[model samples]
Target: MEEEYTLDDPTLLLQAASDFGHHPGVHSDASAKAFLHRFPLPVIINGCKNREVAKGFFMVRGWGKQKGSFSEVGCCVQTEDNRGFGFGEYFLEESRSSREMVMEETGKEFGFWEDLWWGDQPLGTQYPRLFRVVVDKNISISSVLGPSRPFSWNLNFRRNLSDSEIEDLEGLMRSLDDLYLSPSVPDARLWPLSSSGLFSVKSFFLALSQSSGSPQNFPSKFVWNSQVPFKVKSFVWLVAHKKVNTNDMLQVRRPYKALSPDICILCMKHGESADHLFLHCSLTIGLWHRLFQLAKMDWVPPRSIYDMMSIKFKGFDNSKRGIVLWQVANIALIRVVWWERNARIFEDKARNSEFLWDSIVFLASLWAFCSKAFKGIPLNVIQLDWIAVCTP
Candidate 1:
């Protein structure tokens, strides 16, 4: 990608979009003579030949990238400088709407109108800028007359949340099914000694993760499956990817260290990367097969957890199937894996595929019941599921 421009260029900055036309349609001609009508020759090029002339014009005060526009806000002006006086304005007036203008002015907090030199009613003038407002999901903008384009930012909560709003944020977390787990979660104190990640409830949700908008990052592809809701995607990414403190830094809480990091809690032979716990561990693989049979889905053993989630299974759509069965599968898998890990470390419980099998099945049934009962898919579903996951 071209680097984002940090410094400004004088010539390009000086070029206004308002002036490049001759008698009338001349600016449309693209010939050197057309440009000379609006700007002095010296302003463009010292040795003004036709070939060099157009090139020179691009560097002039009102000619280049900032091609003049008559637009007040809505209609688009051609990059070509100088259209008829009313053309771009007519388009703007026709296209612009007051509501859009208001949204841009208020919602995004932008625009420059520090000084107004002069104005006339007939000329009909105002500072042009992108007016954006976040209304539900729709945003509106009014590009005012001239070269500039209007832009708006949709703030999640205006600059800062009010006390009432802050209450709502806290209430939202408490009332809704939990969406995150982190080492620092306040609820960590609630965990029994048997739980492996005995961090606060907040810490469990704050794992380092790729930022939400990264197109290539895994979080981007995390489909809003029936298993997972869109409202909670951000929460999931934080825990799973540990991109808290906004994707640049890792782990919001301290990194989770198993009592012993080297040995797999399930097999006690393998190491614990995501892959080992989710797939290569023999106990986990068996849990996968049994769950697949229970869900009545095809079973292709994943060599790794990433491989498992990465596969394109047939017929996965949310609205239609709510294959909540699929989401249940993921929930069940993660829970079982963590359960097995805790069992080994805290309970000194050894690996038992049979135990893993029974644990996931029972847990899936419990969550499926909760989901159906209007519990609103628990957020700390992992931790909540942990209650039912025994070390044995």
Candidate 2:
């Protein structure tokens, strides 16, 4: 393999797509260009020029290394820029309906304007300027327009002029008359770098990404699987990815350790951490026991949230559906435990283990019944089954 590759190189890009888990035969020239266009040009050009630096930067941001794995790096860039690859634009139908529904309720302009320029229009104030131009009346004008000060300065004053000086100024303004008091409307055809008609490389890439309308990142089967409620799945994703601010995490991140409580709010026996609060705390252990009994399985809680989420119930009742139930139950336990911990700390209230377990049972049943994964299963049936399993 070459040490570097460019977007212009289709074969290498196709290989990169394959490395990113895109099927080999599915990638065509058009598709590859579509994918490559989703990234900033520097991300393509400069990244191709310096492979190690690009790879290192991406790895530090939680992306896995692959030959063509810059897709995720592009996602990180999009996230940092707060300009998703038109996820908002791609779902226009959904957004339009939502926007219309809100309009129906409020009966006013219901959406924000993206390009609204605040304050005065500056239309009349806009004008072209001429500055220290050494023009010789004797010679033909080489170029009348040169670097200039603001038009305000041009209008304000002029020195006592020789007849030739008056002629020169008149010639200069008359030569460039079309530019005087021109409305500075934004150009729609070109990138908004300057009036020089050049591409703003950054804006060009951003516009390219928006025009392609590809997803900011690949679909995550792990997060979007049918086993859990959408809200529960989102919560687990945040926890497993270490995105939430727990006491332990806050202490490590911030210089002031005094800001975060040192002890676990649930147990008050050990330092608080996501793993400890959700999985290992004595208060959470009893809840876990009830969860295991509900599944009728023996499970040693994993040391981390990631592993706990990936745990599959292997008891006698372990069917595909049964596995989903336990997984949903496990994630629900995390959510409830976290909620209870916050309640104790913030609200000065707490629930007992039995109450927590009952919440989990109701939550798990509701999620399963409502989700497409368990569409064939009735709500009452799921509720009864949840109760029967946990009744030991």
Candidate 3:
């Protein structure tokens, strides 16, 4: 025999509010806010329905300036529209027993964490101007959930929520509810939505640090080529992204470049740049010619750094092996020249063009043998002289 009972009015009301708040398609009006306020759940559910209402609610609840706790979490999440909805769903899906266990284990209520994270000030208020700058095009789950900024997360958003929006935020408290109602308890854990486990200020920082941009423009082959060593590949990745501190880039970024010598260390005449260092430097030019000569190929250097690393061989064989060999040589040349430049700067040592060329050949062949799948290329390239092995 089962107990016969219908769902109570409070349960039905809770379901209605959760459904309304969690669905993005459903517009949140003043009436909805008024209704939710009556119930007064522990969690503020519909705060993120729109920017204005969210800010107003925070200000009214004395959470407007909250810095690092759950309020801070809620504030950050509410900055954008959809994040609030996603967060609410995750919050609602979590069971009360699990939340209690997490609270017990951590010895801090959810509000304590909120205040701890967002502490005494608002992120949007402090960096209102820089908000847009931090958010990448493809917003990920971490971007919404974590309060810490991204690697490129320098404060620079275009604008912040307006005064009218802040003024208008009202009546969001009623929708706040625990993840589950009576009888059905869920497993205990923090950050049920996050696979990494644990949600702390440090984890928030990790999330911001891990936030990355869209991969639409990422050069996959140039950075991830199998023929190059991981170290060399990383170096090239920095070069491609223009993050390497070449003299030309340094001059633009820092005031020290104005006082220091801006001339190329390799050329001693021109300004050092990714382009001149790899392509146009007098010393580097000879190395490129030597590589083409060794491969029994003729070539004219490309103008840009990207083109140099990724140029298609127009009149050459264009075979997979040929392309791989060319890129290997290209990456090797870049690595050795950059290394030579650094050696001159840091160690006060310099190598001649001939030594540099030999180093390129040795490195390219060694990396090819060690890092790549060697099938058709000669085995003697590793066993014997790479110059003799590569050249026909």
lDDT of 3 by residue, 1-392 (tens): 22222223433554465456546665333223334445433232432346556455434432223221232121133233433311221222232211211312122222211111232322333333333334442232223333322212122224564664333222111111111222133112244324544333344444444556432345677679647767878889888767787987777787653735777888799988888888889999988777677656788888767776665553124554455656777788888998999999889999899889878877777666654445655645553543433344
Please report the TM-score between candidate 1 and the true structure.
0.33
Q: Model 1's lDDT to the true fold?
A: 0.38
Q: How many pairs of residues collide in model 3?
A: 23
- Tell me the lDDT of model 3 at 90: 23
The Cα error of candidate 1 at residue 84, in Å, is 33
Error of 3 at 185 (Å): 29
- The number of clashing residue pairs in each candidate reads 40, 1, 23
- lDDT value, candidate 3, whole model: 0.51
Q: State residue 206's C-alpha deviation in candidate 1, in Å.
A: 23
lDDT of 1 by residue, 126-169 (tens): 31211111122222111222213222223233346556555654
**1 or 3, which is superior by lDDT?**
3
Best candidate (score: TM-score): 3
Q: Which stretches of candidate 3 lie over 4 Å from their true place?
A: 1-218, 256-259, 314-316, 375-392
Q: Give the residue spans of candidate 2 off by over 4 A.
A: 1-222, 229-231, 387-392
lDDT of each: 0.38, 0.50, 0.51
Q: In lDDT terms, which candidate is top?
A: 3
